[model samples]
Target: MTVHPSVTDLMRRAEDAELARRAHHDALTGLPTRLLLTQTLERVLARRVTHAPIALLLIDLDNFKQVNEFLGHDTGDAVLLQAAQRLVAATRAQDTVARLGGDEFLVLCENTNAAGAGMVAERILHALQHPADGHGAEARVTGSIGIATAAQHHGPTDLLREASAAMRLSKSRGGNQTTLFDLRLGGEAGRLLDIETALREGLERDELVLHYQPIHTLADGSLKGVEALVRWNRPEHGLVPPDDFIPIAEDTGLIVPLGEWVLNEALRQLSTWKRAGVVPANFTISVNLSPVQLLQAGLVDLIDGTIAEHGLTHEDLVLEMTETALILDRSTMMDTVSALAETGASLAIDDFGTGYSSLSYLRYLPAKQLKVDRSFVAGLTTDPRDAALVAAVVRLAHEFGMTCVAEGVETPEQLEHLRLLGCDLAQGYFLGRPATAEVLTRSWAPAGVN
Candidate 1:
C-alpha cells in the first residue's frame, strides 16, 4: 500500500518528537537528563509570579567506580538504574528525578522547603542503601544526598553548585550520609580550595618538609625508629598542620605525589641518620600511606626504587596505614599489602584500636606491628580500662609475633605503664617531639652518647 504525502509528513514529525523526548531522558534509568532538568529548573526560577518552593537533591553513589572497576561496567549500570528507581520512589510525583550522568542523580522537588527536603533526602538515602544489582552485599553501594532549597540561592547555577558542594562534604565525611547546603559549607569549601591551591604550590616550591618523631624502646630508651610526618611550611602560614591539608590532598589525588615525596624524603633522612651512626643498625623509618597510594599500580616498584635510591634496604622502612583503609577495599588491600610485605618492608596498623572491627581485619593483614592510637595511650595512666585495653593489644601483638607501639606517650607515667605492659616502642613529647634533622641530631644524639 502506498502512503500519502500528508501521512509521511505526520510520521516524520512523530519520529522527531520521539527523538527529542529521548534526548531529554536517560537511556538506562529513563529519568530526565541534565538538559531537561536544567531547563525545568530555569523555568521554575524564572517564574517569579507564582512563588513556588523548590529544592534540589544531588545523589552520589559511593564507591560506584569500584563496582565498575571490579564487577564490570554492566554491574555498574544495573546499580545506577536501581538507584534512579529508589530516588523516584522516595520523592513526590511533582518532583523530577534526573540523571546528572555517571553515578550522580538529581532530584528537583517542587513545593518543598528545607525541612521537607530533608525528609525526602533521608528517604532517598535509605532507599539507596540496597545493593544496586541484586547482589548488593558484594557491592555495598550507597548514596550520598545533598539538599539545597531554592530559598538558599537565586539561580539554577548557584543551587546546583551549593548542592554539589554539600554532597562533596557528605562524601568527604564518608558517604551514605545526607547534607543540607549551608553557609558554613560554602566557607568551608572555599577554604579547602584555597588550601588545596596553596598546598600544590607549596609542594612544588619545596616547602614540604619532613619532621621525624623518634620512637624509642620503652625499656632501654634507645631509638627504635621514627615516623615521618609531612608539614607544609608556607611563608605566611608558618607550619600548617598535616591534619589541615593531608585530607585535602587525599581527596584531591594530591596524596599520590605527596606520598611519594614522603617516602623518598623519609628514606633519604633515615639513610643519613644511619651513616651518622646516630640510629641503631636496625632502625627503620615509618611513613603513613593513604588508601589512594595503595591502589597505585606502581606502588611496589615505587617503594623498592625509592629505598634503593637512598641506599636503604626494604627492611629499613616501615609502611603504616589505617585498618579502615584496608577494610574498605579487601581485594586490593590483600594484593597491595602482600606485595609491600614481599618487598621486605614491614607493615604496621596505624591508629590500631580506633576502628570497631579492628580485631576482625587483623587476621587478613600481614602487618608486623600495631601502633596503639593516641586516644588509648592518652588514657593509659588514668583509665584502668584504657590500660587494660592497651595491655591486651600488647599481648595480642606479642602472640602474633609483632611489636606493639604506644603512640602519644605524653607523660613519664604513661611511658612507665607502656613499659610494664610489654610494649616494644613508645613515642611521645615526654621522650622527644617531632623535630628537624638538625635538632634531632643535636638532641637525640646526646642521649645515646651517654
Candidate 2:
C-alpha cells in the first residue's frame, strides 16, 4: 500500500516546522535564542505606538569566566540553566527571556519604559543573588545590565549594541549594577573603543616615548634619580598624556604589554646613559607600576630579565606604585612586593596619604621609600595641617628606616619647608620639568661620570 502524495507532503512540512522551532530555542536552557530575540524585538517595535515603549536589556554575568575556570563546564551549564529559570520567573508573561550565548542573557519587555524595565532589572538582580545549584554545588553570580528603550528611531541592532555598551560601562564601574543607554554614553563608548585601538597601534608603531623628571636631593640640590613617565606621541592626537591613556590601558588589559614596553625602554635608556657616562654610578631610574602589571604571572621574572638585559643592577631600578595598588589584592601584592624586594629593586609607595589609610601595610610591605602626595606638599607653606602631615609622614618613614620624598614642590617656600621637614628627595616643576633623555643628560649630568 503506497502513501498518498498529499500525506507525504504533510509529513515533510511537519518535520520542517519542528526543526525551525528547535533552531529558534536554546537547547541547554530551553529559552529563546538570539534569532528569536531579534524576531520578537522587531515584532514588538512594529506594534509599539508613540506613547507605548519597549525596552531591551543585555545582562552580562560578572566574573562568570571564573566559574567556568574553577568548576567544570558541566557545572557552568547547570548554573546557566538555573539563571535562565530565575530570569523567566522575574519577568512578566509578555516579556521574552533569551539566552544570547555564554553568560549573557537578553530580556525584551513590551509596553515598558525605563521605569518598568528598571523594576524588572532589579528583580532579576535580586533573584540572581541567591545561590544556584551547579552540579550539586552552590554557585553565586552577579549581573551587570544595560537597558535601552525604543526611542529616537533605534533599530534592533542599534538597541542591542547600545545596551551592550551600557552594560560594559556598568562593568567598568565595578559591575553588578544597571545602566541606561544615553546618547552621550554611546559617544563615550565609541571614543574608548577608538582609544584602545590606537593604543595597540601605538605600541606596534613605537609611538610611546619616555620623559624623565629629575628627582633632587633636598639638601645638596644634587640629582637623586629620574622617574620615567610614558607619553604617547600619536600622529593624529599629538602627544596624548599618560593620564588619558593609562587608565584605558589598565581597563583593557593593554597595560600588561604597554608596561613591558615602558620597562624595557626605561632600562635601555638607563643602560645607554650609564655606558655614555651621562649619569653617576649610583644614579637610579624610577618607573611607575600599574596595578594590573603587579598581578601578572612571572612579573618578577620579567623584571629580572629586563634588568639583566640592560646590564643594570636591580638596586639601580625603583618601582613606584600607588597605595591603591596595595589594596587591590593584598596577598598577591604582598607576594609581588616580596619577590621584587628579593631581586634588590627598591619599592616606593607613590601618592601616599591619598589612598588606603591603614598604616598596617607599612609594617609588612617591603617598600624602601614613600612619596608624599602633591596635595600635602602644595599647601605646606600655608596650611598648618598639611605641614604637620608632611612632617608626620617623614617621621614615620624614618622610623621604618625608609626614605621619604615630597612631590610637587612648586615654590621656594615649599622647598624650604620640605627640607626642614627632613624630606630626602623632591620632584616638581620648580625643581625640573619632565624632559627628553638628551636634555636631562645635558643639564643634570653635564660632567658624565665614568
Candidate 3:
C-alpha cells in the first residue's frame, strides 16, 4: 500500500531531524558531543561582554577502568550510557552535557555562579549513586565531580583545567564526592605541594620517623602492644600528619617506598625496645600496611628478610590494613597476608566495617584481630543501634577467633562500655596518645630496667 503524500512528507522531515540529531550527539547515549557543548559555550560566552558568571564541571567515573577490565568493555559502555542518561535527567535543559572522552564528561552551566554549579555537581553525584538498569544485572555507579568558575584570568581551557584539578583533589581525598576550586586555598595548596616535595626526599634525608601508639588490653588495662605510626619530620614543614601527606604519597606512587621505610624503621625500633628492656621480647609490634605496599613484588621476601635480620619471631609482629584496601585488591591482599603469617607475623583488619566488604572475606584472610571503625564507637554513648552494632561486631570477631579492638576509645564511658562488650583491646587518645618512640619507650619501660 502506498503511504499518503502528507504522511510521507512528515516522515521524511522526521528522518532528516533524526540524522541531524545523531550528527551532533553520542550514538550510545544521545548526549551532545564535546564539539557541540564547546560551540554552545562559546556562543554563551561571546554574548557576555560585561562578564556574566559561569561554571565548568568535570565529571569522572572512579574505578571505571577496573570495571571495564574485569567486566568487559560492553559492560563499561552500558555503565557510561546509564551515567549519561542520569546526568541528562539531573541537569537543567539549559545546562550542556558532553562526552569529552572515555569515562569523563563535561558540563557547562551557563548564567550560573559557583554555588549554583556546586548544587548541580551534588545532583550529578546523587544521580550516579542511584541504581542503574544493567540488562538483567543490578549495579550502582558512583562518581566524583569537580567545579570551577570562569575567572578573569581563565579562558575556556583554563576553566576546564581547573575543573580537572578539582576532580583530582576529590580523588586524592578518597573518591565519590565533589570539590570546588577556591582561591582561598592557594596558600594551603602551595604548602601541600611543598610537603609532597619534601616527602619525596624524606627517606633519603632520614627525616621520616615512627611514633608508637600503645594498644592496651581491655581486661587488665595493661599494654599488650604498640602500633608503629609513621610521621614525617620535614626540616622546613615541621611535623606532617599521615592524613595530610599519606594520600599524596599513595597518589604519587610513593607509598611503596614509604611503606618500606616504615617497616624497616618499625622493625629496628622493635629491636631497640627489646634490647632496652622497654617491652617483652615477644610482644607484638604492629605496623600499618598500605595497599600499594601489599601489592608490591617481594613483599613476602622483604618482611621475611627483615624478621630474619631482627631475629624476631613472626608472632612478634602484626600488620594492620584497612578493610577498604582489602576489598580493592583482595587476591594480592590474601597472598601478602598468607606470606606474612608464614613468617610468624600476624595480620589485623584495621578500620573494620567502614567499607562495603562482606564479613565472609574474614575466613580467607590471615587476620588475628578486627579493629572496629572509630565512627561506630564514637556514637556508642547515645545510639543504641551503634552500641548493638559494635557489640555484634565484637561477637563476630570473637566467634571467628579473632581478637576485637575498639578504636577511638576517647572517653571513660566509651572504655567502660567496650569493657562490658568484652572488647579484646582498645586504642585511642584515651588509652594514651601516640608518642615519640623515645617517650613511648620511656613511659612504658619497667622501672630501673633501661
Candidate 4:
C-alpha cells in the first residue's frame, strides 16, 4: 500500500504553495515582484553560454500622478493593472515582466540584442499611449522607456543603473519617448545627479525665491497684475537660472514639491498686499505651472487650498500653462483644466502660438485668457506676418470673450503695436523688469485704485 496524506496535510501544503507564489508576484498587477525579476536576471546572467546579449527595459508612466491625484487612486490602480497587461502583451512569451513599484515596470529579455530591445520598447510605448478603459477619456497616460543591453563587462547593478539613467534622460526631455543608454549619457547623468541632490537640500534650506513681473494695460501702462517667476539662489553659484536647473528637477520628480512651494509663497505675498490695502480687490497674481506639475497629484486641491488658506479668492489667482503642454494629453489635460476653471480662478495659456499650436483645443479649453508668445511680438513692427498674426489673435480672443495678453514687449513701438492691435495686457523688460515683491509693490502698484 502507498502512503496517503491526510486532508489537513493536503490543505497545509496547498496554502504554503499559494504563499510562495504570492511572495514572488506583485499583489496589485500580478506581475513578477522585483525580487523575482532580480533572481531571473541572475539566472540568465550565470547560465549564459551564447554570444547574444540580454537587454533590460524600464517602463515608467509619464504624468501618472495625474491619474492618482485628479482621478481617484482606484482609477490609478485600474490604470496600472491595464498598463501591466499591456506590457505583457507587448513582450515575448519568454520575456519576464515585473512591476518595480508604482507606475514603473521592468522587462528582462534573456537573449535579445539592442535592436530587438528597441523594437520591444517602441511597441510598449505605443501600447501604453492608449486609453486604459474603453472610455477614451480615462487612463490617459504615456510611457517613458529606457533600454540597457548587457556588455562585455557589466553586472546586475550596472544594468539597473544604466536603465535608470536612460529613463531619467527620457523624462528630462518631457517623457513619452525612449532613450538608449550610452557612454555620453554617463557624465551628464552624473552631473544631473549632483544638481538633483543639491536642489533637494536647497529646497529644505528655502533658497528658491519668486520675482514678480508686472502685467500692464498696454494702452496706458497701468499695472493689472504680476506674474510670478521662480529663481534659485544657490550659496556658492550665486543666482542660478531656471533654464539651467528646471530640467534636473523635472527628471528627478522635484518639480512637484518645488511647484507647491511656489504656489503657497506667491499666494502669501498677494495676501500681504491685500492686508496692506496696497493692492486693489481686483488685483491678481499669476503663477507659472510646470508641465510636470500640471499632471502631478492634488493640483486642483492644492491650488484651491492654498488660495483659501492665504485669505484670497480664486479670482485673485491667474494660473498659466504652456499651450504646447496643455495639448499633450488633450483629454486628461482638458479635465484638469476644467476642474481648475470650475474653482473660479482665471486660466491663461502661456506662450501661445509657439510652434505646437493646436487649434482644436482652443475651442474646448475653458481658459478665458491667451498670452501671445513673445516671438511674434519680437517681430511685430518689422514683420507684417507677425503683425497680422498678433492682430488676428487679439481679434480671435475677443470674439471668444477672452483676453489677449502680449509678452516680451521690449520697445515702445512693440507696446504701441500691441495697443493698436487691441491687445489687453503686456509684459516684458520695457513694461517692467521682474522685481522683488517689496520693490514691485512700492514702485509699480498705484497708491490708490478707483
Candidate 5:
C-alpha cells in the first residue's frame, strides 16, 4: 500500500481535474458555470488589443418563475436546457455561453462592439421568445438582456456589475428588451445604492427626525392635530427630503423598521407635550403608515404597546394610509385594520381620491376619515370639475358617517370653498408649514406654555 510518490501524484492530479471540471460546468445544461465564465473572460481581457472589443451580455428569463410554478421543476429544467441550446446556436463558435443558474445566463462575445453586441442580444431574445418543446408541448419565455463592452479598462467584476445593472434596467422597462450600460445608468444605480446604505445607517444612528405639520380645524383654525413627517438629516447630504428616501425604504423593506421608529418617536413627542401641558388631553397625532407596514405581522401589538407606554389613548392617535394600501391583500389587510379600529384608533384614507376611487372601501373597511387628495384640491378654486369632485368627496365622507379633511388648501378662496363644502379639517402651507417641535410648540402651544 506504500505507493511511490509519482503514482500518488498522478492519482491526486486526476481527482483534482475531475473536481475542477465539476465546479466549472453546470450539471443540468452542461454549459460553463460562472467560474469558467470568469476565467474565460479574464483570459480574453488580458489578450484584448485596442479597437478589438469584447462584450458581455447578461440574460435573465422574464416570468420564468411562473413557468416553474405552473408546469413543474422537471419542465423548468427542460426549458432551461432548451434555452442554453438556443443561446449556443445564436452566438459564434468562438463566443462563450455560460449558465449562471436560476433563469440567468451569461454570454461572452469575442471581438464584438456595441452594435454587434446588440445584434447578439436581439438574436438571443428572439430565440428565447419562441416556445421550447417540453413534455410534448411548448413553453413560452422571454429574455431581458444587459450588454457591456470592454471599451473602458474594466476588470471582470466591474464589467459583470455593469452588465447586471443594465439587465435590471431592461427588466424595469418591462423586460424582453436590451439595455447598454452607460455612465448615466451607472451613476443612477450607484446613487440608489448609496441612498440605501445611508438610509439603513440613518435609522440605526438616529439621523432621522420627525417634523410636525399642524392640522387645524377648518372652522376655527385651532390646532386639532399634527401630522408627523419623517426627515433624514443626512450628514453627507444635509436634510434629504422624505420623497427621496421613503420609496427606497419601501422597496427595501426598511419601511417596517422606519415606520416603527416614526410611530414610537411621534408617541414619545406626544407624551412630552402632554406632560408639559402644551397640548390638551384629547389632542391627536397623525402618522402615515406605508402599505408594507400594514401587512407586517404584530403591527397591532407594536402600536398598542407604544400608545400604552406613552399613556395615550387610541383616540389620541390617527393612522393615515393611502388608498392603494387597501387593494393589496384585501382580506388580511381588512382583518388587521379591523383589529386596529377595535383599539379605538382612528383610521384615515390619505390621498383618498387619487387611487382606487371606489366607495366600496368606505362602506366596508373600518375607515373613520377621508383626506381628499391634493391634486383635486390644488385646482379647487379655478377648475369647476375639481371643485365638484372635492364637494362630492366631502359629501360622501359625511354620508358614511366619517370625517373629511381637505389637503393642500393653500389659498383663502380654497379654504372658503372647502368650508362651504363641509370639510372637517384642512392642512396646507397657508395653515402651517412643517416645522420642528420647538417651533410648533412655540407657535401653537397654549399662551402660557414653556
Candidate 6:
C-alpha cells in the first residue's frame, strides 16, 4: 500500500477490466448482455418478496435477417444500434435495456405489472415505427414484444418463459405487435420452438404431405380442378394446421424449400391420378405460389423443369398467385407471370378483391382467372353491396374473357347468388376441405356430372 503502482501494471489492469466489461455487454449497442440480464432477473425476483411489482419486455425485430441479407451486415448493425437507442429512450432510467444477441432486445422494468408492461410495450412499438438510420437509406423496423410480470409466487425462469411465449404469439399474429402471458395454450412459444425443429427435419423424414380441395363449376357442378394445400403430419404433434406453420415458414424463409416440395409432391400426385384414370386428362391442379417463391431467381425455370419432370402439360397445371404478391413489384411480377403463361400454364389471381387489388396491376398481369375472396361471398345474399361487388368482379373478369371463381359458398343461398352473378367456378368448405390423394381418388369420382 505504501509503494506506488507501476505504469505497466496499471495498463494491464485497465485492459483486463475493459475485456471483462465487453464480456458482460453488447459490442454494438453497449447494452447489457444476456449474462447481465440473467443476474438482474435473479436479483429482481429475490426482491419481489418485499418490493413492488416488476416485468420483463422481450422484443424481437421482425424480418431483420431479410434486411441483413438484402442490405449488408453494416446496415443491419446500424439498425440494431438505432433500435437500442430507441429502447433506452422508451424505458425509464430505472429500467435495464439488454441485447440478448441478434435482433433480440430486452427491458427489465422495476415496479411494473402486466398492465404497466403493456403500456411500456405500446410505447416501444410506437417508437420503433419511426425510421432507423442506416447509411443513406432509412430502414423501417418493427418489433414483437412479450411481457412477463414478476409476482411474489412466480419463479424467475417461469416468468421469463411465459414472456417469451407471449412474444412468439405476437410474432405469429404478424410482427410489430405485443401479447401478454396466459396459462392456457400451455406455452405455445415452447411448442413452436419444438415444431420449428421438427419442420426442419420434416422433409428428410417425409413427414410433410399435400392435400387437394376440389373446385367445381357453379353452373353445372362439374369438377374443374383442385387446389393443392400442404399439411404437416408430425410424429408427435399429430396434425399441425397450415395456419400455424405457414406463417412460421414464411418468416423463417423455409417457404422456399417447402414450396418446392409441395409443387413436386402435388405434381407427382397429379401424375398418379392421371395414370389411374381417376382424374380427367383435361383437369388442372392449382398450386398456390408464395411471394418468396415468386421472387426466386430461377422460379420460372424451376417450374418448367418440374412440369417437364412430371411429364405434364402446362394446361394440366395452374398456378394460383395471391393478389397481394402481385401488388409487390408490378413490372417484374408481371414479367414472371407472362413467362409462366409462355410455358402454357394458366394463372389465376386468388383472393382477387382482397389485398390491394390494384386494377393497374391486373391489366399488366397475364391472368386467366379471378377467384373472388370469401368475405365478399359471406354476405352476398343478405347484403346488396356485397352482391354488387361480386357482380362487378364477374363482369370485370368477363370483360377480360377470364373465368371467375367464387370461394366460401357454405349455404345454398350463397351458391345460388354466385350462380346468378354468372361466376364460373366455386370452391369452399361446402365443397370440401382438402383431402389426401387416396381419399380424393376413391370418393371424388367424376362420373356423368359433366
Q: Indicate which candidate wins on TM-score.
A: 4
- Tens digit of per-residue lDDT, candidate 2, span 1-450: 996679879999999887677558766778887768888888777777776888999898886656654654556677878889999999999899997655678999988899999999999999888988888877878899989888858778667766776787888888889998776765667776667778888999999999999898988888878999999999878999998888777654578899999999999999999898888889899999987787665789999999999999999999999876765445456778998998889999999987534376687888899999999999898999999999999999999999999999899999998898789999999988999888877765667633
| Clash pairs, model 4 backbone | none
The model with the greater TM-score, 4 or 6, is: 4
Worst 10 residues of 6 by lDDT: 324-333
The predicted structure with the larger lDDT, 1 or 6, is: 1
lDDT ranking of the models: 2, 5, 4, 1, 6, 3
lDDT of 4: 0.81
- Every model's TM-score: 0.67, 0.66, 0.63, 0.68, 0.64, 0.62
Candidate 4 minimal-lDDT segment of 10 residues: 324-333
Better of 2 and 5 by lDDT: 2
* Candidate 3 to truth, TM: 0.63
* Candidate 4: residue 5 Cα off by (Å): 46
Which candidate wins on lDDT? 2
TM-score order, best first, reads 4, 1, 2, 5, 3, 6
Candidate 2: regions farther than 4 A off: 1-124, 127-168, 171-176, 179-185
lDDT of 6 by residue, 1-450 (tens): 699789999999999998677657766788987667878888778866574888888899987765654555556778888999999999888889997655778899888878988988998999999988789777888999988777677665556556666788998899999988765556676676555657878977989988888899887888888999888998876878899788556534467789999999989888887876777788889999876566554688888899889999888888998865654333345667888888888999998776433465566678888889999999898899998999999999999889999888888888888888889999888877789987887785654213
Q: Write the per-residue lDDT of candidate 1 for residues 340-382, one digit (tens) a residue.
A: 8887889999999776667766666789999899999999878
Candidate 5 has an lDDT of 0.82
Prediction-by-prediction clash tally: 1, 0, 2, 0, 0, 0
lDDT of each: 0.80, 0.83, 0.77, 0.81, 0.82, 0.79
Kindly give the stretch of ten consecutive residues in candidate 2 with the minimal lDDT sum: 65-74
Native-referenced Cα lDDT, model 2? 0.83
For candidate 4, write residues 135-245 as lDDT tens digits.
334768898888889986766756766677788788888999998888676576666656777888999999999999888887676778899989999998988889988
Off by over 4 Å in 6: 1-189, 444-449
